[model samples]
Every structure is written in C-alpha cells, then in structure tokens.
Target: MKDNPLIKTLFAGSQPPHLIDPLALFLLVLIPIGALPLSPSEEIHLFLARTSLLIYLGLRSIQGLIWTGRRNRSDGWVTSISWSSSLFLGIGWGFLSLSWSLSPFTSRSVFLDFFLYISVYGLMTQASLPGKTVKTLYQFLVMMALLVSLDGLSQKFYRYDAYLPYLTEHPEKFDPHTLEIMKNWITTFRRISAHFLLPSHLAGYLILIIPLNVALIQLTPTLWKRVSWLLVLGVNLLVLFFTESYGAWLSLLVVFAFVLLYPLVPRLRRLGRATLQEDSPGQTPGRLLKTIPGIILLSAGTFIVLTLIGYSRGTYLWDLNAPDHPGYLRFLNWKSAFLILRDYPWTGTGLGTFKIAYPPYMLPNSTEANFAHNSYLQIGSELGLPGLLMVCLAAITWFLKGLTTLSTLSDPEDRIIYRSLFAAGLGFCLHNFVDYDVYIPALGLTGFMLLGLGGSGNAEEGEPGRREEPSPLRPSPASPFFNIAWPACLLGLSLWLFILNGKLYLVNIHINQVKKEMEQGEFEKAYQIAQKALFYDPGNPSLQEISGVLLLQLKQPERAARAFQKAIELDPKVPRFHAYLGETYLLRGDLAGAYVETKKAVELFPLRTSYQKRLEEISSLLEKYAVKNRKP
Candidate 1:
C-alpha cells in the first residue's frame, strides 16, 4: 500500500497536503460565516449573501472548467448524476414557473437563491475530501457552532445579539417592516434568534450541526479534538434548549436515536464485522472502533435526557390544533398550502411565491404567514408536485448512495465521519416537517454541504481519499453529444443569470426605492419610481400593485383602475389588488364596476372585514342608484 499520503500526514503531524486543494478550505470557512445574516426567508428581494455564494460558485466553476479535469469515468455517477439530474429538473421547473408565478418578482429572486445554493450542493459533491480537508471542515463546523451558541446566550442574558446590533445603528439600510421584526425579536420575543431571525431558525441550525459534533466526539483521531467537540456539542444543545423549538428538539431525539441505535442492526453488524477484516496497521481494531462509538441505548437515553431538560425549558410537546397552540397556526398554514396546491397542482403558484399566493387560500381564522412551516408542502405549493417529487428523489439518492458508500468504506474513521455527516443532514430533513429551513440560505446550505460531503462524486473504493491513476494531459474524453451539451448547459446557466437575474435585481432596486418613497409619504415620487420599475419589469404583480396604489394616491382613478386590473391579470389570487381596483371604480363613480370587483375581493378573502365592508358599501350605492332610476 505505499502508505497513503494522508495517513502519513496524520501520524507525522506534518503540514497537510495543500496541493490537493486549498480552495475547499476557504469555501468551508465561508459557509458558516455566510449563514449568519442570510438566515431569514426573503420576501420580495434577496439577501446580500447571494453575492458571496456567487463568487464562491464562480471560482468553483472556473476550477471545474479550466483547472480540474472533468470526470471521465462512471465511478460515482449513480450518486452524482442522479442527484444532479433531479435537482436540475427541480430548478428547471422552478425557472419555467416564472411564467405563471403570482408574484414573478419574488419568484425570480427566490429561484435564483435556490439555483445558486443547489449549485453549491452539486459542485461540493465533486470536491476532493482528503483527510486534512475533512478534519478542518469538521473543526469549522464545531468552532462556529460554539460561537453562535455564545451569541444566543448573549441575547438571553445581556439582551444583545451580534447579528442584529448594526441594524439599530443604521436603520435606513433595512426596510421599516424588517426593522419592526428585529425590534420585536429583541423586545417583544423572549426566545433567542442569535445569528438567525427566529428561534426556530437557530434551532434548525443546531439540528444541522450538532450531530456532526456527536460523530466528532466519538470518531476524532485525537483525544483533545474529541473533548473539544463534546464541549461544543453541549453548548449547541444548550442553545437549542433555550430556543424552545419543540420541533428541533423532537427531530434531534429521533435522528440521534436512528444514528446511534440503527447501526446495531444485524445487517450493520455484519458490515462492521466485514470492515474489521480490513483494518489498517496504524489503526485500532474495528471492534474497538464500534460503528456508533458506544451510545447504543439511544431511544431510552434520549428520553431521560429530555426529561432532565424538562422537555426544553418553555417548549411544550406537540400541541392540539388549538388557536392558542404554538403549532396550530402552522397547521393552518399547511392546510392553506394544500389548497394552493389543489389550485395550482401542475406549475404551482410559482417557485417562491407561496407567501404571495397563499393568502387567498388560507383557512378561516388563519393569519398571513411567510412559509407553510413544512418544507415539503411549501415545495409542493411553490414548485408543484413534480418539483416536490424531484427534490424528494434527490434526497433519497443522497441517503441511499451515502449509505452504500458507508458500507463499502474499509477505514473505520472514514465510516464514522460519513455516518456523522449523514445524521446531521438527516436530522435537519426531519426538522423540516415542522420548520422549513431549506428556504433559508444558512440552514439549507449547511445541511446540503454536509449531505454533499457524505457522498463524494470521486469516491470509488469506499475511500474519499483513495487515489486513482491520472487521466492523460488533455480534456476529458466525451461523446460529441455530451461535449456540446455540457457547454450548452453552461451557456444557458450564464444567460439565465446575466439576462433574467440581472433584470430581476434592477427591478428589485427600483421597488426598494418605491417602498422607501411610499413610506416617506412621497406618493408622487414613489409612483415615478414604480413607473420606471415597470419599464424594466412590467409583468411583476408587486410593482403593478404599488403603481396602482400610487395612482390612487395621486387621484388618477381611471389610470389606477387600469393598473389594478393589470395587477389582477398578473396575480388574481391577491385579494387586496382587486379591492384596490374596486376602490378606483368607486372613485370613478362606476357603481357597477365597483360592485363587481368588490364582490370578487369579498369572495376571495371572506375573512377580511375591510373587504366585506367595502362590498356592503358598494351594494348600498347600487341600491341607491336603482331606486333613483326607478323614481326617474
């Protein structure tokens, strides 16, 4: 075995192989840093985190196309191809969804966010997972977890958080609604968000990172490293408890149980025994390095742990569908999402348009929400069932392929690390049942990175670091069809970013300006800004709605009516747009038009007291008109 270079470096305590890759180390570091501010789900625009990810992705794309040799063999095609293809279908479908999106402005922005992050997922799978890179990456996860936990503690005790302090200093940088949310988080809410925007989001991040700490504590090569990981894991758990996120608490218990106990199954035992036969000379016996590293009474152990924590401070167990229950609102959101799916089952309300489209379908007594609180339902409502199917398929492929890779690994340490990453990802997936983390760049990207690392596209002999003979010093041998196809994919992706995404960003800037002007009571200025925005994105329902509002404010009733009608054409599901159009009709003295449009608004959102009152007023006016006509 000409002793593996990585093995040599591990024992020798020499410099790790920098030649293998220094870029992935930078990427690994960037991810934890980026997750902080990018934690919230975007509404009509994107977070600045998108820029950093684009740069990271652009570097990786350059490396793939120019520096690294393209994969020529079918070594890990089952994992790589299947995962990428399914995700591609999901992304492609999301792109197509813009045509039917209820709010194309938001949809396009969200689609770009997903496209970039998922692209990170695909590229990361191909990243070479050598020993030093893997170890360093795990360290980064632990170190950042501890720091974020401390940040949460600060919010609890000192009433200050690292991620939100700057917002107070410069309120103008953020929108008024955003500032209100931040203020509410600090003053109105007791639970800590830390680097995230909500306690649930913080809990979601912990669920994604803590399992790796479990793996690290057991499977780390050194005693000091193991102790540190254990400490970090405890800190993260403490923060998770403080978050009072019941869903994450439950998800952690179940996923940890599965990871720790499931390996004791007879099949896994057989696999462990099989790996024992191939232990390396420097390594301990496989029996000494049991698959779970000795946490076998998982289900009972978790229960005792939960009891000791008092089931996590203020967190109650799963609730009945009561109005006051914490989860009741989520249940309402889910039911409404189901209705949205029923209405737009094929193309969906459009990718990332759930918050825009979901209002009309919300169950009675339900308030407006940004998410379905269920990733699967959100995906279904936003991207349609087929899109959901593709996402599910990608997850299935990652898990199964990762397990297959795990079973084949000859090295005990490699197996442990893989098992740990798998659990981290699995826990987050389970958490999504109650809290939708995948839409948030931080939580979603972290989970995907772990999943990607678990199934390396280059791993062949169950070894992430296993070396293969180098390809000849030339471009990868590909069929004529593939040679052109690969380049075409690149070209299309570039154009999609440059043309469509560029225009989206432009429109977003204008919309932001419009909002600022409107908030300042500068309706004329806002209307002018909106008009300019429409020149760029005439199809965006949001811009049209704002324009209608501005027109109404300017006392231009007929023009406002036209703008509202256009908004209805763009997104008929939004009841307020219809109501505004009805108001325009009322201003114009078209009693018939006012009655018809107001009736439609009331029909769409019967729970709206304002809409109902408006409808009543319209009916009264119509009656008056009829009586006057009869007298004449």
Candidate 2:
C-alpha cells in the first residue's frame, strides 16, 4: 500500500456522514422544550405549547422536503393521496373542533388547538425519524414525566390552598364551580398538576413517556446508558404511582402487554434457532438466545413480586382498588357515563362540550357534575358513535401499521426500534381508556408521536433493501389541482373552526346563564339555560352537571341524580362526583344508596371534609332507615 497521504485523504469518503439532519435536530429540541411544563391551568401555557409544536412541525417538514430533495421519481399520486387524506381528516376534525367550544374566545382557542394537532401530524410525517430526533424526544418525555411526578408529590405534601408553586397562580381564571369541585384535592400528596391539567393527567403523561424511554434505551450503546434509561423509567414510574391515577396505571400495564409481550410469542418460537449476528464479520451465526419454558412463569413471578412490593408500599398500582372499593366513586362515574352514551348514541352533543350537555340526562337528585369521567362515553356522548369510531380507527390504524413494519424487519435493532414505538403507542392508547388524556394537547401530542413512529418507514441496515431512490432534482411547482385542493382544505378547516367557535361560545354563554340563574335562586330558569346550552354544545359535562344541580334545587331528585352520574361518566377520576351523586341520593331518601356513594366519595378523596361529613350524615341516616324498615 503506497502511502500517498494527499491522494488517500482526497478519496476518503466525505467526513463520515452526519447521521442526523441539523434541521430535524433543531426541531426535535425546540418543540418539546417550548412546551416544557407550565401552569396547567393557564390558557397561555396551552397556546404556547400548541404554537411551539406547529412551528417545530413546519420547520421539520421544510427540512424533510429539502433533504429528500425534489426527485423526478417522486410518486405524485402517493404523496397527493397521503396529503389529501390528512387534509380531509383535518377538515373533519376541524368541524368537530367547533362542537364543544365555550365562547367565541374559547372557540378560537379550541380551534387553534384542533388545528395544531393537524399540523403536528403533517410535521411528524414530513420530518422522517432519525436517531437524534428519537433521542431528543426520549429525553423530553423523561424530563416531563419527572417534573410532573415531582409536582404531583409537592401538591400532595404541600397542600396548596392557593396555587401549585411551579405552575400558574391564577385562581381568578378558574370557574368558581370548577374551583369548588377541585377544592378537595388539597389533601393529595403530589404535584401532578398546577391546575391546568389534573393530577391524573400528569400521571397519564408519565405513563405515556415510559414507552419512549424504553425506545431510547434500545438505541443507546453502553450499559450505563441503558441503566440511565432505567433510572428515567423508574423515576417516572414512581411519580406515576404517587399520582393515584389508577386509569393511567392500568393503561400502562395494557400497553406493556400488547406491545412488548405480544411480540414475544413469535420470538419464543425462534428462541433456540440461530440467527445472523451483527458483531461477527461477514454475518456469522450468533449464539442462540434460549427460550425458557418458564419465561411466562418468570414474568408472572416478577409481576407478583412487584405487585407485593407495590401493595405493601401503597403504590398507585394498588390504588385501583380504591375505585373498586365501596367508598370509591368510580362506579358512580361509570354508571353515569353509560347512561349518557345510551341516550345520545348519535351526533353526540359536541366535542369538549360534555360537561354542560350531560346534565339533563343525569341520575335524579344529584349535585352538578363536570365530566363524564370515562373517555369512551365522553366521546360517544360528544361527537356521537361516528366520532368515537373515527378516533378509534385512527388509533388502531396507527398501531397496525407500526406493528406490521416491526414484524417484517429481521434486524434485532430494527425490531427493538419498532417495538419501542409500538410500546409507546400502546401506553397512550391504554392511558386513554381510563383517563381522557386526549383532552390535553401535550399528552395527545406524545401519543401521536408514538403513532408517527409506527407509521414511519425505516431504512434497512446491511444489504439495504433497494432504497426508494431519491427523485430527480427538479422544481416541481404545485399542480393546479394541488393548488386548488390545498386552499380548499384550508378554507374548509377555517370554516369548521369558525362554526365550532360559535357553538362553543354559545354553550359558554348558556352555561354562564345557568350559573347566574342558580345564583339568583331561579332553579327552573337555570335548568332551561342548561338545556339551551346542551342544544348548542350537548357534550358540555360542566353544563350537564350544573343542569343536574339545578334540577336537584328544583326538587327533581331523579333528574339531578342522572345529571351527576353523567358528569362522573364524562370524567371518572374526579372524586367530587361521588359526593354530588351521594347527596342526590340522600335528598331522594335513598339512605342506603346515599351511604354507598358518599362512602366512595370519601375514599377517593380522603382529604375532603365535605365528603367525610356527607358520608357520616348518610351513615347515620342509613342506620335510622334500617331501624325503621325493620320495625315496619
């Protein structure tokens, strides 16, 4: 080998390719960081987060378009189809976006939020996933989880009568009724929220991050790096526990089972078989990883041990029993949700409009409720079965595509990559089942990221599959059809946002009407106002709860109970719902039912002296009722 240093240097491949695209890297860091934890209650916080995501997505797409470089072979049909589908979906959701908006102001806010999700999807697709992007996202999720967990802990221990210290300090912004409902939370032990999103949402956020962390760990090289991932996971898991969000906890377990465990079935079959190894020069047979007969047993054993430790230590995993317990009000929420879903099986009241809409349909004699407590029912009652179906289809489609991509890949690394994506997707999907994390953009974005990972196609390693060769460099202006189509989609989306804004605004006005009427002791007028609000945004659970309260005030016990139940259904994790429903039962002279519900309210929120007092009063009433019944 003649040493011709200059010639050799000239021929040496242009400094090992920068695996990460700079634009993509910039975007990965900026978007999530821009959304960094803010006061959950602050509308500004949400607005900022939404803007950051949109900006990041725009930047990412431009980068992707530039990096991919316009090629002659670019499948115009495929690209058009994909973009068109996205546009249509966005338009549909945009229309939906207006359904539950509170006011012109709230409607505008909500429209922006809805549009943001569309932009996020477009941006995600545009910015093809790179290792650095994955790493950045992973780190963000981990940090967020940690912050939320820590905040949750602080909230619980510090007992904030005013505000969560790290978040916003605006009590004036909150609806007084909303404030009253959440007042009992001062007794909890963590800072899962600063009031913008609830503690349950904070917990759900952590659960969503865990899968991303797992994915990041799979990408790391060193054992220490892997262990660091474990640390992040552990911290998030611990914090999630403190949040007392059993729904999130259950969702996490479901994601683990669906993504990580289900894939293992095929792996177990290939367990003892030899496979090509990356380490061996020229692809040699690697040691066959064993598939133990007791793998299931081992998993079960590990789960058992963890469960024992968690239960003994009073971890969130065991907290689900709270809902199952006689004192926990989860059942009441479930009951209420079902009632709403059954009555409004189609064209739901409206998206995000459940609180106000569900009141008239609630169980009688109940206090006002603010949510459906259940994601499934809430969606069903708001957008109707079709809306629920649309969301479900979107979710399932994302998962199936991701799983398919992962299944066909042979490389262990690739498999892990896809698996991690699947796991992350599973986490969000599961989390949605119990807690409606979808309402919060930050959490929803995280979910969509996992979906994006699933939808994305990865480049093959080793004998690379015939790469989708880059298209020929050309300045292909938008086709006339495309120009028209793009504008049309934008116009449609705008129109929908406008309608949603109007609907939401009207609903808010109607809600305010009810509030004022209630203050004036005009229960019938309040009830009427609530009904009008439902006509505008039938899914407003707050309105529904208020309506139910008004009915109770009007001495309509059955109707009031029904309304409270509906509120619980729209949002089950909120403990006050049980108290409201229990009171309704008491007013109806159903002492036994009152005792049961009040007990549940007390259990879910031990800090609520109001709930405790109700429970005690109900218990005494029940005793007297029992004695009287026996004597009769």
Candidate 2, poorest ten consecutive residues by summed lDDT = 1-10
Error of 2 at 482 (Å): 3.8
Candidate 2 RMSD to the correct structure: 11.8
Model 1 scores what on Cα lDDT? 0.68
Identify the candidate with maximal lDDT.
Answer: 1
In terms of lDDT, the poorest run of 10 residues in model 1 is 10-19
Error (Å) of candidate 1 at residue 25 is: 5.1
Which has the greatest TM-score? 1
Q: In candidate 2, which residue ranges exceed 4 Å CA deviation?
A: 1-29, 52-111, 153-183, 188-196, 264-344, 364-369, 458-479, 491-632
Residues 48-95 of candidate 1 have per-residue lDDT tens digits of: 445555554444333333322233322121123332378877888888
